[model samples]
Target chain A: MNEREVIETLKMIQEEKLDIRTITMGISLRDCADESAKKSCGRIRDKIRRVAGRLAAVGDEIEESYGVPIINRRIAVTPISLVAESSRTDDYLPFALALEDAARDADVNFIGGFSALVHKGMTGGDRKLIDSIPRALAGTDRVCASVNVATTRAGINMDAVSLMGKTIREIAEATKDRGSVGCARLVVFANAPEDNPFMAGAFHGVGEAEAVINVGISGPGVIKSALEKIRGSDLETVAETIKRTSFKITRVGQLVAREAARRLGVPFGIVDVSLAPTPAVGDSVAFILEEMGLESCGAPGSTAALMLLNDAVKKGGLMASSFVGGLSGAFIPVSEDLGMIEAASRGSLSIEKLEAMTAVCSVGLDMIAIPGDTTADTIAAIIADEAAIGVANNKTTAVRVIPVVGRKAGDVVEFGGLLGRAPVIPVSRFASSDFIGRGGRIPAPLQSYRN
Target chain B: MKAIITVVGKDKVGIIAAVSAELAGCGVNILDISQTIMQDNFTMMMSVDLSGSSVSLKELKARLNGIGERMGLVINMYNEELFNSMHRV
Candidate 1:
């Protein structure tokens, strides 16, 4: 590489905070199914241990060799609802425990796929998994649960949606001592992607290969810094800058994903070009939007700016990698993003604005903390609204809100580490219980007839 | 295989000599070298061929990190592919 190129690349890492957010190994647990939940858990643990034995160590080795940080080494297995379906257990807590133990043994921070897809309808296993979410999440530390309540193809499952609302409340109450952290581990999705490498949403779909390596690339800081250099540029120029920066960032992800897959003898999946932000000052996606001339993240032109940002990221990333999947857009998780946290704390950002942003960006109301008194129906309503947006737009969207039990609005709860801290944002005081009480599918939109 | 070794720290004597000695000790051949001093801060970049190195990249990195610690410098060694993949296409 040329001297200027080398210097720029080094600057992107050393100063701009460009890094691989996650390298998720998707392991199919279909073969682990057993009639006994005990036997099933054992098989699950052994399979993960055997497949992901070198995951953390290899991640460390890659970080050292490449001089780029791989922030999370995670695993996504086949949805537990599917894997544990044959097991004759009413409670799936053992399955979650097995995932947690295997993740601990493999040295991965989180294991996803404690999930059920009920967009169409719920099976007995799906019902049991959904019911077990509160206890399962409360019982385990590293296991994440996700439920798909709506899809463009299958429409919205209001019954599952209503159930999830109550489930989220139970999860919050069960983990009340820990600031309702269990809710943070639970994601409610609409049109959720199978190959997503991001947390609270990742799952190995039945359509996927037995094993694959997926990477999530992050660098809102780099894009923001790039835009900072071209201050006062036109909109087209701004879009071009973001696209070029995203291309470069995703190239690193592709390289790491390929290397990890080769070393682990797994097929390389896709590189998710998601501009996932951390709580660090410079890594916020909201800062990138603000840098695009917004007064704040929730300003009038915020959605327009985010649309430009998200589209450009995808356009650039599509060219850099052979395949691109997952929620490959800018994530606006409130607490995990310093800029969003500040905006929310200052009252410039609201849940309504965040919901609007999700229509254009990646994910839904994420990492947000709400008042403890917020009812289950209200949380479910929030999920339904976010799901409607995803279904109508035919994109991936998810909610990972934490209702800090016993905390009121404006109170701050610290989750520490990568989960970060969040200020309890106010929710609508008006009741949504009557609407949520009517349980049936929100019929598929006309757009679903495209095929 | 090739890698880039970057050193950044306060300017001091024998920084290059120390870094080069460590690389040579591991049988890593230096392909190119660039050095500059900016505002009393020493910054050096080297392109080294590690195909003939006796140690693995991880071991070489650990050794270089140890040397950097002892010399009070911020030393980083990265595979050349990181730059190529990012900057090329």
Candidate 2:
């Protein structure tokens, strides 16, 4: 290799926050079902340990060999609602605990599967799992839960959406001492991806192999730095610059994903080339927007800027890997991004502006904090709005807002480390209880006519 | 297998002699060396082949890291594929 190339790669790693965000092992637990909840829990733990025993060790070895950091090693199993159906139990708390125990034993950062997909309707097990989410997230340290309440083909399940609002309030109160941090470990999604390698939404789908390795690569700082070189570029030039940097970043992801899968003796899954930002300085998707001449993130023309970025990242990543999937676009989670946190703390960024941006960006209403007294109907209304956007546009959208207990607007609650702090974004005080009270389904939009 | 070694720190003498002598001791072959000084700081890049090295690649990295510590520099050895995959394609 030439000296210039080596120096550039090193600078990207040391200065620009270029790294693989996660290496997730997807394992299907469909066969671990039993009539007894206790027996099912036992089988779940043993299956996870046996399948992912060398996962973390292999991750460490690859990190050393490549001189690039792989920040998290996690596991995703089939949704527990399916596996626990055969068990004659009303509570799925034991299933969540089993997954947490297996995560600790396998040396993974988090385990996700305590999830239910009730996009159209809810089965008995699905309803039980949804009821269990509040206690499941509060009780386990390393377990994450997600509920998919809307899909483009099946339409929005208003019943599940309304229930999730109450579930989120319960989670916040259950873990209120920690600034409602439990809510950060849960997500409500519309059209959630089954093979997502990232956090609270990842799950091993029914059609996946027995085991696979999926990698998530993040480099918001890298793309921001690239944009700095051309100070007065046009919009076309800005898109071109972002596309080139994303290509280089995603190639490394494909490499790490390939090597990790090879050493672990599992088939390699897709690489999620997302511009996921962190709380660290110089590591934010908002900075990339600001670098493109926006006064600040969420300012006027913010939606246009985010649209360019999201499309360019996907185009570049699609060219770099033969198999690219997951949410391969820019993520604008407020608390997790430094520039976004700054903008929100000032009154420049609001929940309303964020909702508009989500119509074009990757995710929706992520990591925002709301006042404690906000009604469940209001939260459900927000989810319904976000779901309508995803279903109409035929894309993925999600909500993970934390209603900090005993906190109000302009009050900042600290979540420390990765899940940073957020100022409570004020909600409209006007009630929507009447609308949410009439629970039914929002029929599929006309866009679902692809037959 | 091949690896790239990079040294970055304040400029000083004997940096080359100390590094090459250690590489020779491990029976490693040096293919190319590039050294440059800018703004009173030292940066050196080396391309090395470890197929015939007596010690493992991990051992050689540890030895180089030890030398870098004594000399107050930041030294790193990375697999060449990291560069090839990102820059070549």
Candidate 3:
């Protein structure tokens, strides 16, 4: 063992906040489906508890033994819509509640997959699951929900997009007392990944194995700390530093992922090396972009900075881990990042700039708060625009904006914890109801037609 | 079967003697040891073979943590594979 490298690794953990963000166990709930809703919910709960009973314990073991904090233990199940659709029910809230109960039993903080993949169209169950999202999220504390209204292969479903806008509004209204925090747990996505270990968007795709363990490695602080050492260096050196740092970070993720999978007797899945930021000042991806000579994260050169970062992160992480998937780039959740919060609050970071950054960064329009009076059509339009970007680029995009009820622009809303605090930023005043009212599918872009 | 133990804190007499005594009592054989004073603080690194030890890794950590808290030092024992995985690979 090299003492110098040991000291460096320990220093990275002790001061630089290098840590495994999440260890997510993806369990297929396909076998839990039944014609009866009650039976289906019961089976779902039982299977989750049985398969994931040791998940949190194993995560704790890995954390303690490796000296890396595994911050979250999560479970992403097969989308409830696929299972609940076979059940004779219009309401899928019971399925969400079952997930909530199972996660609590297993001592997991968050359980994702109260979701529907309706990029092409919505079936009866998909519509039911989407309809029940507001109620499920408002009622459960740990259950997360996602709706994929667009994909590179399927294009955008304007009807689903329109419905999601209304659904988000309903969630805002239902959880109004909690600063509309329920909306924070709901993510609307374009080209959503099947094995994402991150919350509000993770789900086990149908083609995935019966059970798998996917890990998300987060180290914005680690990368920033590395960049600080090479100050005054050129962009080429900065990119190289990021790539090298990312490789080391992803190796930690691979170690934890393989250990967790071994202990849980589940097949190992991908390691999502997303520079997932939190509310902590030291752990901000925005600060990394700022560290690369930008005045602030959302400055004029920010998109280029983020593009270099995203590409380098993917390149570095691809070789370190056996499997690399999910939104494997830098995440810019405005509310969840301290530097981004500072920039957005100072008016340097705008929604328009974020949309551009999304084209280069990992996901799109994430955790942004807009005006309360923003219409559903306008929200739908925003989703449509973001979806267009994802489909055209053949990448994933998502919108998890909270239109805080009765709050206008320039107000702050605290959702607390990892969801963080968001500032209510302004959007365009121009209306797009006509375009949204024409509720039909936006055809798949030329880029998506690749065979 | 192998582990790396890192101890960092203020320099003190009998630090090595106390740590080695604990390892000897637990039947853990120290393969190599390195000690240095970086700046003003004392730092020690140990590569140990734990295959013959009677204690589990979790229990060994608890014991070391007790010693650390009393000595005003930070002590950590991790599976050696962790170092090889991150720093080597």
Off by over 4 Å in 2: A448-451, B39-41
- Can you write out model 3's per-residue Cα lDDT over A85-115, one digit (the tens) per residue? 9999888889999999999999998999998
Each candidate structure's TM-score, on Cα atoms with residue i matched to residue i, is 0.96, 0.97, 0.97
TM-score of 2: 0.97
lDDT tens string, model 1, A379-412?
8899899999999998888888888899999999
Candidate 3 at residue A351, lDDT?
98
**Better candidate number, 1 or 2, judged by TM-score:** 2
Q: Is candidate 1 or candidate 2 better by lDDT?
A: 1
DockQ winner between 2 and 3, please give it: 2
What lDDT tens digits, residue by residue, belong to model 2 across residues A1-451?
7777898899899999899999999999999999999999999999999999999999999988888999999999999999999999999999999999999999998898789999999999999998999899899889999889999999999999999989999999999998888999898999998889988788998889999999999999999889999889799999998898899999999999999999999999899989888899989999888898888898999999999999999988998987898778899999999999889988889999999999998878999999988888899999999998898899999999999999999999889888888889998888888998899999988964655
How well does candidate 1 reproduce the true complex, by DockQ?
0.72
lDDT of 2 at A425: 90
Which regions of candidate 1 fall more than 4 Å away from where they truly are? A448-451, B8-16, B35-43, B62-74
| DockQ-better candidate, 1 vs 2 | 2
Of the two candidates 1 and 3, the one with more favorable DockQ, higher being better, is: 1
